[model samples]
Target chain A: MKLPLLFTDELRGFYKSKLMLILWIGLPIIALLFRFAQTTSTGQDIPFTVISTIVISSLAGTLSSVMLAVSIINEKNRNVYTLFLIRPLKRRELLLAKFLSVYICVTIASLLAVFVGMTTDYITTGMLSTKLIDNTAQSLVTSLSMLAVSCAAGVLIGVASPSVMVGAILVIYGGNQISVIPLMPTILNITYATLFTTTTTLLTCSLLLIAAIGLFERKQF
Target chain B: MSPRNFRNQFVVLREVTKKYGGLTALKKISFEIGEGEIFGYIGPNGAGKTTTMKILVGLLTDFEGEVYIGGFQVPKQKSEVHKLLGYLPQSVGFQEWRTVDHALKTFGKLSGLTETEIEKRITEVLDLLALSEVRHKKIAQLSGGMTQKVGLGQAILHNPKLLILDEPLNGLDPLSRYQFKEVLLKLSKGGTTILFSSHILSDVQDVADRIGIINRGQIKQVGTLNELKEHLAEQRTVEVLLTYATDKWREFQNIKHVKSVEQPSVGRILVNIEKGSDPDDVMNDLAQLIVKQKIRIRGINLLSPSLDDIYQKYVQEGESI
Candidate 1:
């Protein structure tokens, strides 16, 4: 009961946020402009899908990190957790609810951004291919999943740290680097981008949620 | 459900202790508050008042010992207890970007209020708190007093049985303060048991049916205002203002428990008492002295200890539990 209610409430708060709105529109706008400039310059064989991956990953990391860090730090400073805890709400449930809300919002926003960028790239080129659209969709899924990993890293830092600036730095900077776990040591072979994105995203998010709940449960307030 | 069903259950705190690393936040504290009773919890800063409040609300569960709210064990039945508890935390963030209406609607729904009920209560509470004009304003745009009122409005909107407010009146203006008191009194009359903690002596004295003083995590005293006054009677002192300074003889020099008598202000002097002495006795002795000395026309009476005096006696004294 509490988990769903909390998730709904948090979703309402996040989707209506100015930051989410900015990312949903502005990030794609920037990605489209960069792709347009690139196509005009080289005019060779640059995949808009690749550019979308780069833009979405970078933007999603920054967005998720700042969003998670600000709210968590502000809540910690103001003791918002105490209010929820008194309402039949468990610490773990609260943490999970927040993570779910932010992750879902980011996922939706990231998809929208990818679609806008892909549509623009297709429009500018006017050479539509079902194969290109499929690849774009596949790449969109990959980037969003990668962003999910980034968001999970944010949740961990948000719960562990006491300040927003510190948490933001740790998540945005540290998350982008640490999310390369699948690519490191050729351990996962970095084979099949879809598999890598799915496995890395789910595993990373789960671990972060665990650490967040553990720390949040033992938090002073 | 009948309120009487939980009448026998107030709050049962048994051997509850909270330790933070090396610092003991709360020692082994045990007590019970009866249903429908207003319990005032007072303590200095960092005295663990918030800690104890957190435990009762099921916010701090890593502590030692058991807490039962309405006869249901906290760790075990926290969900049931939460259904019955309305809590106002000392400081809470509300996302701050949404309109007051949106925030209230969400909180109301989360508290299990039906949509229609939430709508009606939202309007009624906003009007009651004189915040109807600003209902559409974002929380970030609200003043401290208005924000606090919003916090309180959300807590009471669902109408729970036990209302726990941690410094509920911190930012209210004088008028809002009175209005809040009126609201609380109305709720009490409607039979909602309240447990509020504050460092403000007068507010606690005004609203609480009983006040519990805690220092260093131990509850030193807990009772009604009159009962606490009676308990601290021994520390009570008498003050007198004479018409003429030199008119009264120094007969108080012979009175027992009359530690010192000094005319600090013109025509007025405070009569300090020895430890563990009654103000009544001091008054009776002064009356005899007045009769014997034929002191000039003046004012003489034992000062009934104010909540301030009582608070100082307990918290400042740092008495052992």
Candidate 2:
């Protein structure tokens, strides 16, 4: 009950943040720009939906991760969690709420961008084939998995870093690299690409979240 | 442990000691607050007032102590204690994006209040804190005093049995301070036990039924205003006002009971009495000396040490050590 309440509070805060506005409006605009560029260029058979998913995933994932890490660090330094901690709320719930809120928002933004890209593909090419649908679904799954890893790493860096600058730096350098791990099997063309991305997402996200919770529980504030 | 006395005590700390590595923030300090009583925890900066409040609120857990809030041990039974406690931290911050109403609603819901109750309490708290006009305003838009009031509003939104406020009056204007003190007194009258910390002596002297002076992580003294004044009762001074400007009042210093004499103004002299001397005898002696010296006296009054004096004495003593 407390977790959900905190999650709603955090979601409401993130929903109105400038970062959320950028993700919601910026991602779709980027997809449209990609579609226009593809049409103007050589007009080759390009999987716009897959390309948009990858592009949106990278953009939304890094932005959301940086937002999470920086917000948490700023709030910690400002002692914003003092009032919340004094209530009947667990330390782990606070971190989990932040992670879930940012993850859900980024996921929604990613889906919106992918939908825009799919609509452009259908309009330009005038066909929705089985191969295209399969490719889009796989890309969407990989994108979501990558987001999970990035969000978890954001929380970890947020909990561990001392300041917002350090947290943002770590998220860009360390956290972005960690999120790329889920995209490994796809790049290498593994036998079970989907299965491997799913496994890596679960394992890495859980490990990062567990480490974050441990550090947060011991935190004095 | 000593004999358990839970008759009227709502919060109790026995031999509580907390340390950060080799630096001890709190020593073997002990104190108790009665139900519905306002216990003023006063100390200078870095005097462990915040550390003690944090321990009571269950924010700092690793410590050796026996702490009980409404008979529930802290950190061990913090969940149970949390239900009956409301805390406003010294340097607490709110999310700048959140409106005053939104922030209060979040705190209200987290406190397990029903939707209806939260709405009602929000209205009541906002009005009480004079923050109704800023209900829809973002926290970042509020002034320092308004923001501090919002912090107070959330702390009392749930109406817990015990409210622990750490430096709750730090950033308030004079009018806001008066109104805030009125709110505290009203809350106390409504049977809410409050333990507020402040370095402002006059504020504590006005609101606290019993004040605790802490310094160097040690409990220096704890008692009511008069009781603390009595601690320095023997060191009383008398203010003597002369009808005409003259230095003849210095003759009072030659009396046996008179310790020293100094003129604070052109016609007003302050006579310090000896420790064991009777104030009445000293007054009589000064009167006789003034008549003998042909000096006309306008008025004379005995004065006790102010809270400022007592606080400085204790704090300066701690600093010297």
Candidate 3:
């Protein structure tokens, strides 16, 4: 009963937020602009779909990190959670509701941007290549994993930090930077880099979620 | 429901102590609220009124000792207790982006009400609290009074058995405060057990069946207005209205058991009854003296201590508001 109510309420709240609009419409427009700017400078064919996918996935990571962090901190400081906590609601359920709502919204926005980039490329190139598909798919998976880790880290910071500014700083500078740790072996040209990155990212997300839930449960609000 | 439990206790706190870091927020507080009783918790700022309310609402689980609501242990059977509770947190903030109706709907759903039942309750509470006109307006655009009403509305949306309101009238205008008090009284009359906190003595005195005054994280006293005044009966006053004014009323001070006498107005004499003196006996003696003095008498009235006096006397030493 509570999960649906909390989830729907959070979705409505974030969907109408100014930051969500920036992620939804502004990110896609920026990706299209980057694609156009690239064709004029490089002269050689570069897949606009691939470029847009990479740009959007990256934006999702950084944006979701800051957004979820600031949102949770503000809610905590304002004591908005008090209304829910005093009811028959669980601490884990509250955190999970917020996490799932933000995650789903950010995921949809990222995919939309990727779709726009793919459509733009198809329109311009008149053909899609197998290698390009492989590269775009790989980037999509990496971006999503990084985004998940960043979102979880954002929750951890929001729960642990005593102030909103500190939480935001941790999310923007610390969490955004650390989200790339799982992908580090790829730069070193290691074999099975994808497997290593995915496992470590999921484990890190699990730990961060556990920590967030524990802190929230013990928090006095 | 009957107004009395087997032991006449609907809520009980036993040696309930709460501490924050090194500071004790509540020091071995113990009290009982009878079934269907309107229990007012009053204290100065930071006097642990909110802390006690939070513990009762199950929002604070780290406190020592136990609190029972309807014989169920709190924070352990918190979810079960929640079914019977409606809380309006002090200075609570709603999602300002939501309309009043939407906010109520969310809370109603969380309280486990069906859609049809919630809709009916929405209409009932909005009309009851005079919030019908602003039901569709966003909370961000509401006045403080309107927001307070919304908080109250959500609390009562499920018609809870126990209503815990912390400073529900803190920032309301006088008219709104009066209206809120009426709502509380109406709920109490309908068999709801209300535990509300306020610093406004008049508001507490008006609606409370019993009052608890806390100071320095300890409960100073708890009783009905009459009971508290009777407890502090060392000094009492009787006001007498005479047909004519007199400066010679000071002579009556010499009468036995009469501590002092003053003419607050030309024809009104206020006589202070000394401690341990039977006010009835003193009044009988004073009547004979007044008759002998040939003072044309209009009326003699005993004045009870006001709630302000009682609250101040109990909360501090020899302090009067």
Candidate 4:
């Protein structure tokens, strides 16, 4: 019951933050530019859909993680949560609300990138291939799973570390390194690669959320 | 409120102790605030005032003892207590992006009020705090005094039974301080028991019906202003500004109630008296004696210890230990 209010509040908050703009508008623009440059340089019909999907996935993974980490740490250090904690609100509701809001915003940004990428592919190639469709669809699922894990992991670091710099460093260097593993089986032609990454990511995200909630519940504001 | 009504305690802390690593923040703090009474919690910097407040409001749960509000345990029945209490923290940092009305609305909803109730209370609180003019203004655009006023507004919006305020007057100007006190007076009049912590002695003396002096995480004393004065009233000093220095001032020491008489300056004589002795009687006695001896007199003044003096005395005693 309380989560809904907190979710709406945090969602509205994130929508107004500069991070939203960077993810929703700025990141997609960069992905488009990168795809155009790749096509121009290669002089071969490199599918714009594949390049844009890669860019969005990679950028969303790193940017959403950093965004959630910094937001949680800043709120903690500034005692902003004090106002909410003194009420009937639970600690888990707060952390979970922030996680869901950031995750949802980044997911929307990724979907927008995919739509833009496919339209560009249609305009440049004049047709859509079945292979491109399958790859784009697979990449979307993989990217969603990876982004969820990264955002949750970032929240864990934010709650566990006392300083913002330490949390951000861990998210960028430590978390970023671990998140790349989910994509490995995909390229290696391992059996049920999507299943493997999806299962591992869901498990990791759940563990990270539990760890974050435990830390936040015991935190003194 | 009747004196008997104030005797019924509304809040109690039984040997509450809090420590952080190696540092002891609160050392067995124990006191009670009666219903409808303004209890002022006063102490110096780093004296554990905020810790005590946090414990009462359920913000800090890991502590060493018991706290009961309206007969409900803290941090366990915290939600039940939240319905009855309102808290104003020392330094409130509102989100700069939210407007004043929106921020208050959010707090009102968090306090479990419905939309209509939240609207009504927001209007009432804004009017009470004189913040109606800036209700829609962004928080970042408000001045310091206005910010403090909004902080106070949110605290009393729900009209809670107990209001816990930490350093509520930390940075307010004189006029704002006065207005804040007036709002508190109004709240207390409406049967709201207030526990206000402040480092400003005069402000405490002005509004608090009773005062608790804390130092080094220990409560040195808790009593009404008169009760505290009476505790130290045993020793009173009378200073007389005389027209001329008198070598015969020692002769007046024959009065049985007079403890000692000394002239530390050219035209001033200080007479020390025992407890329960009447200052007016001493002044009259000295006046009669001066007239009988044809002594020239300028003025007679009675100097009793103020609340500031009492606070300093307790703080110094704690420090000396």
Candidate 5:
């Protein structure tokens, strides 16, 4: 009960944040620009759908991670969680709420970007190719999985970093890199992309989120 | 007597001790606050006032003590205790992107109030805290005093039985402070038990039904205002105002039972009397000495110790030890 309430509260907060505004409006624009660039170029083999998925995922995931890390560090420093902790809310719920909200927002933005890119692909080419659809689906799944890992890593950094500067630095330098690890097995073609990515995403995200919750529970504030 | 023996005690701490690494933030402290009573937890900086409040609210779980709030043990039955407790931390910040109404609504909902109850409480809290006009304003746009009021507003939005406020009055202006005190008094009258911590003596003296003086992480004393004042009643002083700027009042120092005499101003002399001496007898001797010395006196009166004196004495004692 409390988790949902806190998650809703955090969702509302993130929904109104400047970062969400940028993601909502900026990501689709970036997708359109990538589609326009691909259409203008001759002999372009890469589909805009696949291109936009990776681009949007990388951009949205990094920005969201930084935003999550900095906000968490700032709120912790400001003792914002004190009021929540004093309520019936658990510390893990607070972290989980933040993770879920940011991940959901980023996922929505990524989907919007990919959808816009796919729509443009269909309008330009006159029909949606099965191969293009298959590639888009694969890229979208991998991107979302990587995003889950990135968001969880962002939460871990937020919980561990002592200050906003340090949190942001860690998220930018080390946190975003976590997204690529799950993608590695797929990139190498060593295993089934969907199975491996989903397994790795669940395992890594759970580990990072559990570590974050442990740190948060032990935190003094 | 043990704090547990108090009738209707809403909060109790028995031998509460907390340490951080090598430094003990709270000693073996003990105190009790009865139902609906305003308990002022007063102390200087780093005196463990915040620590004690945190423990009571179940924020600080690593401590040695027996703490019970509304019959629920702290950190053990914290969830049940949380239902009956409202806490305003010493220094807290809201998500800056939230409007005043949004923040309160979130807190109201998290406190388990129904939607209708949340809306009603939001309206009531905003009006009570004089925040109705700023209901739509973002928290970052509000002034420091307004922000503090918002902090208070959320704490009381659910109307819990016990409220624990740490330095709730730190950033308020004079008018806001007066209004905040009035709100507290009104809440207390409505049967809400409040334990607020502050270094400001006058504020505590004004609102606290019982004051607890904590220093060096120890409960130095806890009693009603008058009871604490009576603790230092024996060490009394007499203030004398002379008709003219003359040093003749200095002669009272030689009178019986007079401990010392010093002229603080040209026409004012403060006489310190012996601890066990009868103040009436000392005043009599001073009056007789004034007449014998042919000094015209305008007024002379015994001075009772103010809260400032009591606070200073206890805090200074804590420092020295």
Candidate 6:
């Protein structure tokens, strides 16, 4: 189905919003703080880029999920759906647009933090290991996949949960548990672990997004 | 398909029925609307006016009805039907955070206008509705009338051939109501078939080309305003305004055709008739008695019953039946 043309503008507005702004800049600043604090306390310099990526990725995932849930739940209660139902908008497209916009924003915030922090770390350290660079790229890919999954979960909770409070509880307690486990696996992985995690996250996200779209399409309002 | 012939014979509701769980909101209600026609669908609250409008605009399709817009079935052809239809819901809210321009842009895109074309059309609709200055204002900042205008603008932004307005005049101030009426009239003149619902009778009486009055989920009356007024008049009733109020007015109780003499207010008396009362005889006798009483009077006059009177007459008659 064609992504609804109607929600693109809404997506743009949301992506540039204050909530996304804090996530984009604040995550990197948090990475800088972590490195500075670590240096002051332990006197052993931590890789600023690596810490930035981890912090930003985790924050992005959580923020994206909550933003998705809050926006959909709030709009639903406002009878905003009534406005589009009268027009030619498809429900599936609306759900997809919202998911994609939040996911992309969170991903951008993560990437910006990692790239900038990595550049600064390289300058200070004067050298980077090949294995570390490869690991960094793998971590970025995995984190993006995880963020996508969180976004899809948010959409699912939005579609399934009838109200914002319920969706929030579900997203924070219910969705985070399942999606977050993939990021921090208890099982030991010898090789190709990042690829396995990325694939599983993408699959989960796709299934959840499909389910969300179907549920939304069937909603009365 | 040519837009003229297309717009002319639009909004065909065939054997439409809506059942909510065990309750039937609408039962096999059907009507046809043509271009340049202001069709007023009036009824009491919960009389399925909103339900019918919802079906027409493809909102509530759980209905067992075939709503056709420009020859498109509502359910099977909703994608096409919605393309040609503009619906203003009874109570739909905008995202308060969005500016008027932003909201209109979203609505325009959803209505299938191209991006650049959507902007141009937004400008046109805003200017047409005199909302150009408020385009940048947030929805939270606008007045009720201005917001209603924005709602109306969103509906007509893409210039749909068929427009459905559910209680569009509700909660509007008098001036806003007049402006809205003019906007609807202008759209109707442009070959847009308007299917509007209102409970207020006088508003519809002024502009509606054809009226369908639904009561308790069924259409009780449908015709031109004059025809409806006449039909209700023919149904066991004649209204006689007496030239003067006198204790002698109690004598109307003695007349065979005078079923009941009711003093509605201090100056007005309603002489309700039985099943077959000769209106001519009733008026003549009433005038003769008033003249003989030597009562200082204004003038005796026969009045066509209004929609409110018709509603009271039928509702009472229906209840007693």
Q: All candidates: CA RMSD in angstroms?
A: 3.8, 3.2, 2.7, 2.1, 2.9, 3.9
Q: Please name the candidate that would achieve the greatest DockQ relative to the true structure.
A: 2
Instruction: Give Cα distance to truth, residue A53, candidate 6, Å.
Output: 2.6
Candidate 5 residue spans exceeding 4 A from truth: A35-43, B1-6, B245-251, B288-295
**Chain A alone, TM-score per model:** 0.86, 0.94, 0.91, 0.94, 0.94, 0.89
Flag clash pairs in model 2.
none
lDDT score at residue B60, model 5, on the 0-100 scale = 91
Model 3's interface RMSD = 1.2
List of chain B TM-scores, one per candidate: 0.90, 0.94, 0.92, 0.93, 0.94, 0.84
Candidate 5: residue A170 Cα off by (Å): 1.6
TM-score of each: 0.89, 0.95, 0.94, 0.95, 0.94, 0.89
Candidate 3 vs candidate 6: the TM-score winner is 3
Per-residue lDDT of B1-321 in model 5, one digit per residue for the tens? 112123599999999999999999998999999988889999899999999999999989999989999999998998999999999988868988899988888888888999999999999988998999999999999998899899999999999999999999998888999999999999987989999988788998889888899999999989988888778788779999989888677678898888999987788899999988899999988888888898987899999888899899999998898
lDDT of 4: 0.85
Clashing pairs in 4: none
Q: Model 1, which residues run further than 4 Å from truth?
A: A40-45, A181-197, B1-9, B235-238, B252-262, B269-292, B319-321
Residue-pair clash count for candidate 1: 0
lDDT of 1 by residue, A1-221 (tens): 67888887787776676655776677777777778888788987566656766787677766776677678887877766666666655778776777788778777767776777666667778866888787777766666676676777777788887787788778766877765653332344465767766776678778877887788877756
Model 5 vs. true fold: TM? 0.94
Q: Poorest 10 consecutive residues of model 5 chain B by lDDT?
A: B1-10
Of the pair 4 and 5, which is ahead by TM-score?
Answer: 4
lDDT per residue, candidate 4, B1-321, as tens digits? Answer: 122248678899989999999999999999999998999999899888999999999989999989999888998899898888988888887765778898888888888889999999999988887789999998879988788788888788778999999999988999889989999999988999999999888999899989899999999999888788878778888887878777767766976688899888887888998778887788788778878877777887888789999999889999999
Worst 10 residues of 2 chain B by lDDT: B1-10
* Residue B6 accuracy (lDDT) in model 5: 30
Q: Give the Å error, residue B223, model 4.
A: 0.6
lDDT string, candidate 1, B1-321, tens digits: 112222554788988899988999998888777777778889899888888888888877789999998878886787898888888888856776678898788778767889999999999899888899999999889998888888888888888888888898898888998998888877877888888887777888888877888889887897788888888886556788777877354567679888887777777767888878766777888888877787774788777888998899888778543
Show what share of the native A-B interface contacts model 6 retains: 0.63
- Best first by lDDT, ranked: 2, 5, 4, 3, 1, 6
The stretch of ten residues in a row with the least summed lDDT in candidate 6 chain A is A181-190
Error of 3 at B48 (Å): 0.9
| Each candidate's interface RMSD | 1.8, 0.9, 1.2, 1.3, 0.9, 2.0
